[model samples]
Structure formats: structure tokens, C-alpha cells
Target: MFAEIKNIKSEKSDLRKFGITIGVILLVIAGFLFWKEKESFQIILAIGITLFIAGIVKPNILKP
Candidate 1:
């Protein structure tokens, strides 16, 4: 009963979704900067890694 009220207090507390999105966005921006630096190898590596992790991560954006 009380759990419902507590859940509404903070959406970020969702276990199914962590701070992965924020990290991904930041990684993308950083990757872009690195790419402009002529670091194509690392750009591919970072993008591949970010996509791989994002694909497996289950983000909870709703109250189930």
C-alpha cells in the first residue's frame, strides 16, 4: 500500500532503468569530439561498445 506513494516520489529510483541513457548521450558527444580529432579507431570502438551495452540494458521509463 505505502509502496505506491513512495514510488511516485522519485522516478529515477526505477531498478530496471539506471543512468545508462545519460551516460550514452555523454559518450556520443565525447565520441564526436574525439572523431574531429582524427581518432577514428577510438570513435568506432566507443560507438560499438555503447550500442552493445545499450542493446542489452533494459531501461524502465514507465511505472509497471
Candidate 2:
């Protein structure tokens, strides 16, 4: 009952490496599209870069 529900909520799924990689690439490309009119996308690119870097570092950190 409660224990079963707790176990389900406690599980943390691993990040999807392949999908993240593709998204990071797309973000980088979109970041370059600077028309001075489309400004919100730059932040998205920055976040993507940050996520990519974190993804790389996370694996290394966990490895023995």
C-alpha cells in the first residue's frame, strides 16, 4: 500500500544520454540564430550547454 507507493516515488530514472546529446546540439545551433528579435532562445541554449557539461561531469564523478 503506502510502502509500494513510496518505492515507486523514490526511484530516480537515469538521464537519456542520446536524446540529451541531440537536444544539446540543437540548442547550440539555435543559439547562433541571433536576429536581436528572438531573445528568449539564447537562455535555452545556455541551459542546454549547462546540462551537457553536467551530464559529462556526472558520469565521471560516479565512476570508481
lDDT values of the candidates?
A: 0.53, 0.55
Model 2, span 1-64: residue lDDT tens: 8667545422112333633575588576766665445777777777676666655555332221
lDDT of 1 by residue, 1-64 (tens): 6878665633534432334544466577767767678566466557645544543464343333
Candidate 1 lDDT for residue 15: 32
Return the lDDT, model 2, position 52.
69
Error of 2 at 37 (Å): 4.1
Report the Cα lDDT for residue 50, model 2: 66
Clash count per candidate: 0, 0
Model 2, which residues run further than 4 Å from truth? 1-19, 22-29, 32-37, 59-64
Per-candidate RMSD vs. true structure? 8.0, 6.7
* Pairs of colliding residues, candidate 2: none
TM-score versus the correct structure, for each prediction: 0.35, 0.44
In candidate 1, residue 56 scores what lDDT?
44
